[model samples]
Structure formats: structure tokens, C-alpha cells
Target: MRVIVVGAGEVGTNIAERLQDAHDVVMIDRDRERVESITYDQDVLALEGNGTSLETLEEAGLERADMVIASTDIDETNVVICGAAKAMDDAFTIARIKRTNLLRTWERSEEAFGVDFMVCTDLHAAEAIVDIAGLPGARDVDSFANGLVRMAEFDVKPTSPIAGETVAEADRYESLTFAAILRDDDVVIPEGETVIQPHDAVVVIGSEESVREFAGSLTPAPTLEQANEVVVVGGSEVGYQTARLFEAAGLEPRLLERDPDRARELAERLPQTLVLQSDATDIDFLVREHVDESDIVVAALESDEKNLLVSLLAKRIGVGRTIGVVEYGEYADLFETVGMDVAINPRLVTAEEITRFTREHRTEKLAMLEHDRAEVLEIEVDADSVLCKTRIREVMADLPEGVVIGAVTRDGELITPRGETVLEGGDHVVVFVDTEVLDEVAAAL
Candidate 1:
């Protein structure tokens, strides 16, 4: 596949790095230093030019490319580039738009923008946050099988239903399956004899309905209206989007902005949300506003240091959950270690979304779990594939130590795989595998 990527920033560079080995990648950027840096660090053709220009797209061989991805930081520029690319060829076009309204306009009718798909970093991150935030103990949640199936990660509490039960004893749900457990730093691929322990981070896969039922049974029922209490700190696009999503979901979320002008604008834009003008990093102001008493505190500040400090202060003041946006990928782990319940990096999230397009299998969906420790893939079984017409027991034995098939879809029905279950061609299977064994699992399948 010939992929012409516009922009050589973090997200574009990541997409290029992942696709270079599999696709013919050509990256365009106006910054000579960024182009040179990507050229030296990655095996991609780095072209320094204005991506929105017709001549630049032509220079990057847009006519022969299979796909053109516009991922510049500016949403308008990306939309223009995709529209321009479409005029040249019928290549699949994807545009990364940060603003939700612009994204919605293109999504309603792509003819004007010529965008086949849209990736909104702010909206996606906010959705991710809402998925986990609404769930009491959940750290991450991703859906597959067109929202019928879900992979959820959360810590096992002492009062959890499955905490003291072995896998066999806990196999009460018809669709729920325990995929893996993270104990300390080790990822345990559990079996029937494996016992779930308290504080251990567990990953579960099942139909959306059944998984939510199982989750409710595992943890104490959240207080009525508890999920609606949320405090968002930051006036950035990501922060505003998060507040918007929460408000749309019937939650009157409070938004804090250090800039009075931005606060006023947000108040007008989002009448459902409580917009306050104040620095979130100030512990006195946070306490005065009772921010720490909220169900969740989200730090979407521009600087990583501010986010870290705000989250730490929130945690110290007894916020039920603290989520921070880590500007740098390297600081994500540190943020989590220091007390933030979840540290999300927009660049990494965007990269993960793009990776679904580069898979070697018939992957309908893909998501990174446990901070990239494992990957959840919804892949279809080809007629001639090794996995076709295989017994579940033998297939499990043949698979590597860190991989497991969580669910199978046949004829639009979800199937929970057992030892004697036989998998046939045309079945869509959802598998959870450690990052190290992803290649082996793909090869075996």
C-alpha cells in the first residue's frame, strides 16, 4: 500500500513509523527540521512541502497512492489536504480534525471535504475518559463487534464478586471471559485454576450487555447520580470536548479555566456545563470549589507538570478518581505511578486508532489495552486460514502463552469459546494477546 501522510508531527511520525515496514510511506511537512528528523529516524520518504498544495501532493505521488492521511495539527489544513487529495485520485482519505463541530459537518456529508473517515483526537480522548469514568473502578474500556463486544480493564476490589473466586468458580456469566490479569508487573494469562486477587488489574472481554452486568456484580453498585459529579480542569480543546461529552450524557460537568476570556466563551458555548474562571493548580481554589469532592477530576492542562500537580493534589484531597492528560508519552507511566488513576496521551491514542488500518489480518477493530501491554483485535477468519475448522482446545494449545480468544461471532451471533467449540471459516474472533506475542498470534491465525 502506498500511503502519503501529510504532516511530520508526533502523530504523523508515529503513523509513518508503524506503516513504513508494510507500506510505501511518503511524509510531507513544511518544516525542514521535522522532515529531516523523520528521515533520519524512520524508513519513510520525508518530503518538505505544503501538504495542502496540489503540486506538493503530486510530488508525493498522490495519484498512485492507496491512501492519503491528513494529520496536521490544524484541523482546517487537514480538511483542505484531504479535499485536495481526493480531487487527484480516488484514494481512501482520512482527516484528523480536532474540533467536533467541523468533524460532524464532514461526517454528515464527506462530499465537500472528500474525507472517507475522520479522527478527532479531542473527541476520542473524551469518549475514552467517559467510558472509564462512568464505570466506578474501570481504567479503560473499548468496544468491538460493532459495540456488541467490549474489552474492559479495572482493578479487582476486596468486595468484588470475582476477587476471591477461581476462574472456574467465577465462570457464571454466559458471555463474560477473563482474558488476563496484571499482578504487580506480571501479566497472567489465567486458567480455570487461577484465583483472582484483590488490587490485581483484570481484563475482561464479552458482549457489552453481559460485561456491564458482570462489572456491576463484581463491584459495589455506584451511588445514584455519582457518575454525574465530574470536575474538568483546563480550557483546551480536549478539556472542552470532555466537558461537552459529559454534559451530553446528562451530567452537568463543571469546567475550570485559568483564562477568564476562554471561560466566558465556554460558558456561552456550553450552557449545560458550569464554566469557572480560575487556575486549577491552586489547591486553595480547588478546595474552595469542592473539586476534590467530585466523583472524578480530569486534568487536561497544557503542561504535563501542571496536570501532574493538579492530579496529585486532587488525589491528596480525596477525589474518587483522578485522570490526567500526559503531554509527553514518557510521562504517562510516571503520572499513573504518582497517583493519577488514568494518564492518557492524545498522540498515542491517535496512533493506536491509525494502527487498525495497517494490520495484516481482516481486523475489523483494534485497541491497545493496559497501556499497550496487550492488544485487543477483532479479526475475521479466512476460509483458508489455519484457524478455520479447528477445535478450540487444540487452537489454545498451539497459541503462544500470552494470547487468548475471548469471543467469536458467527452469523451475527456472539459465541463464547469453550474447549470443544469448533471454529469455522467466516467467523469473526476477538483475541487478546500481549504485545510481545502479537506477531506470533497473527502468524498462527
Candidate 2:
């Protein structure tokens, strides 16, 4: 598909960079430096111009585009850009919105902004934070088949029970499969003979119960002894939404904000949450306010440095778990190295979400694993495909080494595929694949 991305900002650049590997991506940005940078850095056509201009869209070959993604910083500009693209070409349009109010307005009337899909960076990031916080020992987690099947990544510790066990021996869970392991920067799709090492991040996919049990065997998140003891150290949109999600999940979270006005505002909006107007960096204040008693500490400050400091402070004070929201993608690894359990990058979350829509294949759901080393895609099998009438075990050799069919859903029923389980024409298959073999798996199925 010829996809046109109309921004060279963080989110747009990431989307274009990832999509360029599989699709013909054209990026348009008014900034000359960004346009030149992307042109030199990525395998995509970069154009410098106002994206909202009709002439710029024409120059970008909008007529030939299968999809148009407007991801500029300005929400109104993105909406206008999508609307313009919709008027000219018969292409699917996607708009990035930073504000929830604009999203709400668009949601009230479907296709209000001529966008087939809408992605909000803050919301995606907040939801990801919530997902990780809700699960014990999960640095990253994604669900498939209506939460029946889940894949979670756990940072292996020296004290972990299965640290030195072979994959075959460690994977004793009936419903679980060790999907992939991250040893330092390298991604390993573990074989049965592969040995699990300490400090390696292992990803596993299985039934919810089985995954939870496996997570518990590792360095799991500390359990919340009290009902409302989660501390959120920011009043930003992501922080506010994280608190909101916690409230929805029956957890009373305390939110701390440095700005008095913002803290008061959050207090009013989040009546259930105990909003504190104090600097979270102050160890004295944290101890005085009893923030140390909280089981989980979420750092969602605007600055990456501040978030890291908050996480470090929480850890120093013996907070059960510390999750840091790092804005820059590079800082995520640093956070992991510094003992921050989870680092949620909003840009990566938004990029993964948008990249899924840009895929030519009919992908129902998609997630990135191991710092984008691999992707888990849930694709509906077509009738004419080679896998339509074959039993999975028979085609084991033909399937790529990096690809593993995690789960199958037929007629809305989850089927745990075993050696003898047959694949039908229209089965919704959940596949975990190394990025190298993504195209091969897509072609096979």
C-alpha cells in the first residue's frame, strides 16, 4: 500500500519508519530539517511542504495513496488534513488527536473528521500503563481473543525460579508457550533446548490464568495489601487517565502534582483519588505524606529526567513497583537498567497502533514485543490460502522458524492448537513472529 504520513514529528516519523519496511511510505513535513533527516535516515520519500495544502497532497501522490495518516502536533490541522485527503482520494484516513475533547466530538458522530480511525497518544500510553500496572511482573502485556489469550514480558531476575532452566523444562504450563526472550539488546525466539538466563526479558503467551501463574514464578509485581494505595506522581493527561483507569478497576489511587492549580483541578475531577499538591522529587514530602506506603508508584511527569528521578526515589524508599513514563524512546532502556520495572513510551504505543492500520493484510490486532524486535499479529485467514485446509502439525517444517501460532479462534471460540489441531479457512489466528519472518508468515497464511 502507498501510505502517506503528513507529519515528521516523533509519532509520524516512527510510523513512517516502521511502515517503510513493508509499504511505500511518503512523508510530508513543512520543516526542512526534519524532511532532510527522514530522507537521509529512512527508506521513504520525504517531501517538505504544508501538509494541509492541496498542491502538497497532489505532489505526494495522494491519488495513488491507499492510506493517509495525519499526525501533526495540531489536532485541528490533522483533522483538516484528513478531511482534505478524504475529499480528493478514495483512501482510508487516520488522524492523531492529542486532546480527548476532540476525540469525544468525533466519536459522537462517526466519520465526523473524515477519519476512518483515530489514535490518541496520551490515551494509548495511559492504557498501556494501566495494563502493565494491573498485571503482576509484567513490563509489557498485550491481549488477544477478547482477553482469553495474553502475552506478557517479564524481566528475568537472578532469584527467578526458572532462571537457568531450559525452555522445555521451564515451560511446564499446559497452555503457555515461551514466545520470545530478550537478552540485552538481542531478541531470541527460544527453542526447546534454549536455556533461560538471569536478567533476560522473556515473553510468554498463553491462557490468562497460565500466564499469571508463570508471572508469579518470576519477579512479579508486589501485591497491593490495601485497597487504595497506588501512588501516581504526576497530574498530566497520562497520569490523570491512569488514575481514572485505576478507579474504574476499583483501586483508589493517590495522584501527586507539582502545580497547585493543576493539582486542585485534578482533585476536583478525580474526587476518589487523593490529589496531593507537592513535588514528588522531595523524599521528605513523600515520607511525610505516607506515599512510601503505596504498593505501586507511577511516574508520569512531563520530563523524562523527572520521571526517572521519581521512579528511583520510589525504588529507594522501597515502593513495591515503579513504572516510569519515558517520553524519548532511548530513555526506556535506561529506565530498565536503572531498576524501573516498566517504561511506557507513548510514541511507541501510538506508532504500533497506527502501523497496524497501515498493514495491507487484514490484521484484527497487532502488538510489538521486545522493543519492536518482533510483532504479534492476529490475522483472519483467507479461504484460498495454503493454511486453509491444512493441519498445523503437518506444516510445521514449512512454517518459518520465527513464527509461532499462539492461539486460534473459530466461531468466537478459543482453540488451543496442539500437534493434531487442524486449521480451517476463516480461523482467527494469533501469530507471534520475529520481525524478520513477518512477511513470510503473512504470505503463508
Candidate 3:
């Protein structure tokens, strides 16, 4: 694939990094520093020019690009870039925008805004938060096989019940597959006797019910349905979207906005959400509203610092869980380390969405894990494919060491892979591949 990525910010840079190993990538940015930095750090051509300009697109070889991605921070600029790129070539175009309104407009028609695909950053981040909220003790969650199969990453705390158990002991769930254990810089493909240590990010893929049961065994907290008390501390777009999604899930979440006009608008827009016009930093206001009694507190203020402060306050006030919306991707680990149960970065979420779209035709679905250290891919088996009609035990010898068959679905039914199981054509298989051998696994499977 020959890919041209506009805007060398976090989202664009991440997309470029993910595709550089397998595709010919070109990146464009108006900032000289960003261009130089990406040129130094990645194996791609970096051009310092306005991406929306025709001459700049030509200079970046847009005529030959297989895909063009517009990912500038500004929503209008990204749309303009995609429009310009689409007017030139037959390349697949993707745009990243922060507003849900723009996405709704694009969905009204085919190839709207000249973009083949669009990813809304704020909405994606909010959805990520809601997904994490539903599964207790899960640091990250993504669904595959049309939501029939689920993948969850749990940070095993020292006090967690399964922290010291072996993989065999923890394999109590019927339809679950222990995909990988992320221990520091290493991606460990666990065996039956492999011990799950504290601080290990354990990745599991399986049926929705089995995954939820495994999540329940990890922590004592109830699921989002059982624990309906959720407080959203901000009226920012992400916060508003988060509250709306929770409401759609049959939850009446509380939203706090400092500005009176914004609070009134939110109250009118979100009928199910309880909108309170008060500064979230005020201890008196939180106590008066009974925020301390909430099961989940979401910090989605305008700035990362403010969100961090609110998350810390929520923790101090005895909230069961805290989900912080992090503007900067680098601060995600920092927020999690400082007691935030989950840190959702909108840019990273947008990048992941766009990356998944890029793999649409080849793979049914894709989920990147541990910042692209590994990926979970859903691929349909065909007669000519290597996995077709193959027994699981025999197929394992041909696959690389890091590849794991997580789940299989046929006729809309879950088929857990085992040593003696044989796969057939038309079956969908969810696979976990270490990024180091992703290309090899993709070819073999």
C-alpha cells in the first residue's frame, strides 16, 4: 500500500508508524519541526507543506497514493484536506474530526466530504470509556465477530485474585482464550503452566458471556448495568458524548458543568442525564450532589491537568472507578499510574479507528493492543487459505511462535479452538499476532 498521511500530529504519526513496515508511507505537515521529527524517527518521506493545497498534494505524490488520510487537529482543515485529495485521485480517503455533527453530515451521503471513511475523535473516546465501564477490572475492551466475541485487557494488580495463578488454573471460563500476557516490554504467549504475575496486562478473547464471567472473577465490583451510578464531571464534547452513550445504555448518569449556559443546554439535550451547574473542583458542590457515592466518576474536562485533578478528587472522595479523558497520548500511562482506572486518549482512539478502516477489505476486523505491540485480527476462512479445513494441532506447526487463534465463529455460533478441532471454509477466526511477526502471520494464515 502506498499511503499519504496529512498532518504529522499524534494521530497521523501513529498511522504512519503502523503502516511504514508494510507499506510505502508519505507524511505531510506545515510544521517544519514535526516534519523533521517524523523524518528522523520513521522510515517514511516527510514533506513540510499545506496538505490542502493542490501543488502540495502533487509534490507528495498523491497521484500514486493508494490511500490518503487527513488527520489534522482542526476539523475543518482535515475535511478540506480530504476533499482536496479526493478531487485528485482514486485513493481511499479518511478524515479525522472532533465533532459528531460533521460525522453525521458525512453519513448522510455516499463519499460525503470527499472522504471514503471518517472517524470522530470525541465520540470514539467516549465510546471507549463506556466500553471500559461495562467490564469491571478491564483496562481496555474491544469487540469482534459482530460483538459475538470480545477482547479485554486487564491489568492484574498484586491483590487481584488471579494475579498469582497459572494460566491453567485461571482458564476456568468455558469459552475464553488467554491470548497474551504483556509483561513490561515483553509480549508473552502464555501456556497452561505460565504464571500470571502482578502488573501483567492479561489479554483474553472469547464469547461475551465468558469474558464477562472472567471479568467478574477478577474484581468484586459490579458491571455497569448493576452499578448504575455514574458521574460525568464536565460539559465538554467528550463528557457530553460520554453521558449520552451511558444514557443510551439504559443508565442515567449525572453531568456537572461549571458554565450555566452550557449546563442548561446539556440539560435540554440530554433528557436522561442530570445536569448540575457547579464547578467540579468545589468540594462542597460534589458532596451536596452526592458525587462521592457514585460508582464511576469520569473526568473529561477541557484540559489534561484539570481532568487529572478531578480524577484525583474523585478517588479521594471514594468513587469506585475513575476514567480520565487524556488529550495527550503520552500522559495516558501517567494518568493511570496516578490512580485513574482508565485514561482514554481521543487522538489514539481516532488513529485506531482509521487504521482499522484501512484494513477493512483484507481483514474483517482489527484491534491494536499495547500501542501496536500486537494486533487481534478477524479473518474469514476460504478454500484456498492455509487455515481452511486444517486441524488446530497440525496448523500450529506452520504458524509462527507469537500467533494465537483466539476464537472461531461459524453459522453465527462460537467455536472455541482446541488441539483436535478442525476448521472449515467460511468460518471466521479471531487471531492474535505479535507485531514483530504480523506480516509473516498474515501471509501464512
Candidate 4:
């Protein structure tokens, strides 16, 4: 597919690189130096001009482009570029809008701009932070296309029943597939004889039913529990956004702010939550609020140091989970080192959303990892496909490299699948294939 990316910042660069493997990508930036850098470094077509200009877009062959992504740091520029592209070809268009108000407008009136998709980075990041804050035990949660399928990463405890079981034995379960094992820093694709060891971070991909079965198979199981009481430190925009998502998810949250007026305003805005006018740095205030009873404490103050300090204090006060929202990317490692359950940078999250919206066709959202460059997608068995009526084991050698069937869904039931499992028409097969080989994998299936 022919694609045009309007921006050369971190987000644009990421989108360009991701699509370059399988599509003809043209990247544009206002900075000549940045354009030259991308052109030489990535071997991609780069043009230096205002992407919002129609002449500049036409010069990049926007008429023949299948997709045009507007991801400039400036929200207005992104909107203009997307609007221009939509007017030009009515092609798939995505815009990265960062302002909270613009997001609200986009949600209420997306059709007016002719945008195929709208990604609000701050909102996505806030949602991710809320998920991690709410469920600290999950190492990672990858929601697939509209949340139909989910891949969760969790550590195998020492007491897990299947700790020593081989891959083939584990696959005997009708549901759940052991996608991949992350041991230390290396990723291992397990085979039949491969054994799972304790402390291994395993990625499990399946439908909700299959995932539940997989989680239950462990001796020391992991369960998603609702937080009876949650506390969020700071009443900033991100903090308010995080609290809103938690409340929508049926969790009770208490928001603490230093200013009484701001607290009152937030209290009115979020009537479902309790708003306290108190400084989060005040240990006495936190203790007085019964922080011990809080299941999760999220530190989302504007200052990174304050967020980190409050998170540590909350952890020390017996809060079951602590999450900190750090704006600076450099502070991410610090939060991880201090044992914060999760730390999110809004810029990175927004960049990822833009990248996903820009890149199309190789994999559906359900097969791709959250914020991952490559994807593992699921494809339904078509009547004319080469994989039909064949046993999985027999066809393994003929399959393209970097692609493997992870699981199969038939008649609304999930299966781990084995070599003897025969491909049947209408089966939804989950295959882990590199983006480069996605077309080959699709053709084979």
C-alpha cells in the first residue's frame, strides 16, 4: 500500500519505520535536516514542507496514496493535514490530536472532518495508566481490536501447577495458547518439549474464555478483582481522566488535591468520586484518609519527583498497588526501579496510537501487541485457502518463516491446537507472523 506520513517526530518516525517493511511510505517534515536524516537513515522518501499545504501533499502523490496520517506535534496542523487529505482522495485518514478539548470535539463530531480514525494520545495514555493502576498484578495487557481478544503477560509463580509442564502437555487444554515466554531479556518460542520454569514472563493469547481457563490452570492463580476503594493523588487533567475511567469501570475513587477551589470544581465535575482538598505530600493527610484501606493509589501530580515520592509513600503505607504518571520519558526507569506497578508517558502512548491508526492491512488490531512494532494476527479460514483440510503439524514446514499458529477459534470455542488439529473452514486461527511476512502468511491461510 502507498502511505504518506506527515511528521518526522518520534511518532511519525515510528509509523514510517513500521510501514516501510511492507508499504511504500513517504514521510514529510518541516525541518529539512530531519527530512534528510529520515531519508538517509531509513531509506524512505522524505519531503520537507508544511504537510497541511495541498501543494506539498500533492507533490508527495497524495492522490495515489491509500492512507495519509497526520501526526505533527501541533494539533491544529494535524487536523489541517487530515482534512486536506480527506478532501483530496477520501482515503483513510488519521489525526493525532493532543488537546483535551479537541478530543472531546473529535469524539462528538468525527464525521465532519472526514477522519477515518481519531487518536487522542493523552486519553490513550490515561486509559493505559488507569488499567495498570487498577490491575497491578498484570505485567501487561494487550487489548485486541475493540477488545474482542486480549493477550496478557504474567509471571509464572514458583508454586504454579504447570511450572514444570512441557509445552505439548500445556497445549492439551482445549483453550489457551502459550504465545511466547520472556525469560530474562530473551524471548523464547516454546516447542512441544519446552518446559515452563518459575519466574518466566509468559504471554498468553486467547479469547476471554480461553484466557480464564489458562489463568485457572496455574496453582497460584491470578484474578481480576475490583478495587473497593481507590485513591488518586493530584487533580490534574490526566489524574481526572484516569479517575473517570476507573469510575466507569465500576471502581470507587477518591481524588486528592491541594487547592480547595480546584477540588470543589473537580468534585462537581466528578460527582461519583470523593474530592479532598489536601496535599498528597502530607503524610498525615494520606494516613488520615485511611490510605491503608485503599486497594490502589495512583500518584499523578504534575511533578515527577512528587509522583514518585507519593507512590513510594503509598506503597510503604500498605497500599496494595501504586502507579505513577511521569511526563518525562527519562523518569520511566526510575519509577520501574522503585517498584511502581506502572508508569506511563503520554507522548509515547499518543505516538503508539498514531502509529497503529496510520498502518493498515497487514494485521488487524486484535493480532498486534499494544505499542509493538510487529504484530501477530488472526485470519479466518477461507474456502480457497491452502491451509484448509490440512493438519497443522503437516503444514508447519510449508508455512512462511516468522509465522506460527498460536491458537484457533471454532464455533465460538477456543483451542490451544496441536499438530494433529486439522484446519477447518470458518475457523478463526491466530497466527504470529512478522509484519514483513504478513502477506505471505495471509496467502498461505
1-445: candidate 3 lDDT, tens digit per residue: 8899999999999999988888899999999999999989999999999999999999989999999999998999989988998888989999999999999999998788899888999999999999999999898899988899999999998998898999999999999999999999999999999999999999999999999999998888989999858999999999999999999999999999999999999999999999999999998778877899999999999999999999998889888999999989899998889888899988888888888766646488888887889999999888877788889888888888998999999989999989888998888889999999988887777
* Per-candidate total of colliding backbone pairs: 0, 1, 0, 0
Off by over 4 Å in 2: 223-228
Which runs in model 3 stand beyond 4 Å of their true positions?
none
Error of 4 at 413 (Å): 4.1
Report the lDDT tens digits of candidate 4 across residue range 1-445.
7889998887788778767877899998999999989988995799999999999999999989988988888988888888899888867898887667887777788465767777877677678776555333555566553454656666677887668888887775445677777676556767779898988867777666666566556522223354578888999888888888877877668999998999999999987899999999888888888987787788888898899889888888888777787777677767867767667777666666655554334334442443452366656676666778989987787876655677776777666678899988777777665555665655565
The most accurate candidate by TM-score is 3
Residue-wise C-alpha lDDT for candidate 1, range 1-445, written one tens digit per residue: 8999998887888788767876899999999999889889999999999999999999999889988999999999999999898988998888887888887787687465888888888888877877777666677888888777888987787878788889889778779889999898788999999999998988989987777777777665453245647899998988998888888788898999999999999999898899999988788998898886787888998899999989999988878788888867888887788788899888778878877876774888999865567888998888888888998889989988998889988988899888888889988889999877877787787
TM-score-wise, the better of 3 and 4 is 3
TM-score of 3: 0.98
List candidate 1 stretches off by more than 4 Å: 53-59, 155-174, 182-188, 194-200, 209-225, 380-390, 394-401, 410-413, 424-427, 437-440, 443-445
Q: Each model's C-alpha lDDT?
A: 0.85, 0.86, 0.91, 0.74
lDDT of 1 at 390: 90
How do the predictions measure up, each by TM-score? 0.85, 0.96, 0.98, 0.83
Go through the candidates in order and give the C-alpha RMSD of each one to the true structure.
3.4, 1.7, 1.2, 3.7
At residue 144, candidate 2 shows an lDDT of 85
